[model samples]
Target: MSPLKSYLDLYKHLPQTNCKKCGMAACLAFAAAAMRGQKLLSACPDLAPQVREELARELGQAADPQEELTRAMAPLKARVAAVDLAAKAGQLGCTHNGKRLVLKCLGKDFTVDPDGSLASQCHVNAWLAEPMLNYVSLGQGKDPLGRWKLLRELPGGEDWHRLFGQRCEKPLQKVIDEHRDLMEWVIDIFGAQAVEEEGSAELRVVLWPLPKLPLLIRYWPPEDGMESTLNLCFDATATDNLPIESIYTLGVGLVTMLEKIALTHDT
Candidate 1:
């Protein structure tokens, strides 16, 4: 048992600004990371000097967060088992081949067995599995509207925007900054389609993470005293296809995959 019993214990104390001052995309992310022992409480510059110091003293004593993740996922996994995957496949714009329901994620095939276990030819990343199960079990399965909006603009996205930027957009910007030339190749590998935007984006691409879920990215290289930028946006119907938390997880997972792709090719 740790002094910080749960992430909310610390979340309640913060400014809730979602400011990136702590190097985390959002205040909520920082608190959760701190609870997981991945970050220090003192890392948040916004916290009172005394408060941060006090919390920092208790941070190192936190319990294992892996158990918490497991506890959180258990019910979602159980829900998958109760779902008639084959019967619901069509609604999800996926396929059923008797034994498994096959869903396409970021142009990759991930098959779900009747027991809620997932298998993919590609590695099943920890960030992606939970969301996949969640989508299959509870997603609204609506078709995307093709109209794009920021994570902050989507339903329930206000709370998640900063974290989404931290986990997805900022990392994508980092990749573009370091490996500018290789981006075309990376996007190509993911079958991303080049597109245009009004803001003079040097590169804009669209990708379909799911049949009803589309992601759009726009990048602007450094110029005229402005830093480089990358923005990851989603369809207006994003929440209809996946929950806000799952959407954030999926974005993080995509960024992780992009980093891997860039690394593998740059070498």
Candidate 2:
């Protein structure tokens, strides 16, 4: 059997009922997990026997998470090799240093070579590399409109909103709750700016993860028996500069970085 080439292919075989029986909130999420080899086809009890057998044959063998990420990033890297870095720099409001395209990522200068190889003082990993490549290859170079909106408000964002919250906002909120100085550290380390917005939030900080992709994070401290809340918003033109998946990836990446920093400080 041929291996499944994409998540959508795996998703089509699922029940699509958005039933949480598989431990994933939606069938789409389950499919994504399966593609990443984090979940097995048989884990979805609702799957028909025939479909399970077919998927088992087509999926070949489950790969480790690192291997899955490498496999998924292969195509994006190939595409990056085909793009002219200097040309993309102009289109994406980046600077080219003759050998690489430089863009501001989380206020740090990130450089990408023509072969999709990335370099920065910050950590580099498949998660960040994939999105950076996508931005260079597909981003439309739209200027941020300054109007902030929730991720769900972006085109095609509704389906991803739940996962985004679980993977990005909730985890980041936990980090902040545990480390009282986290918000201030992010502002200082990432060059984030504290912005005053008309809201009940006790703190609001704006960060530029990409040149045109600015993220606004708001934190509402616990009050009146209510738990604290953290929300992430982006410029309305975010999707125009990077696809929704890249946006989600960037958010998760940022949180992961902060989590590591917090851990180091705790140690």
Best by TM-score: 2
**TM-score of each model, paired residue for residue:** 0.74, 0.78
Q: Candidate 2 lDDT, tens digit per residue, 199-227?
A: 65578899987777889988888889999
Clashing pairs in 1: none
**Candidate 2: minimum summed lDDT over ten consecutive residues — where?**
61-70
lDDT tens digits by residue: candidate 1, 39-77: 656556678866766675666432334553555456677
- Cα lDDT over the full model 2: 0.81
How does residue 190 of candidate 1 score in lDDT? 64
C-alpha lDDT of all candidate models, in order? 0.80, 0.81
lDDT of 1: 0.80
Stretches off by above 4 angstroms in model 1 are 1-72, 196-201
RMSD values, in order shown: 6.1, 5.3
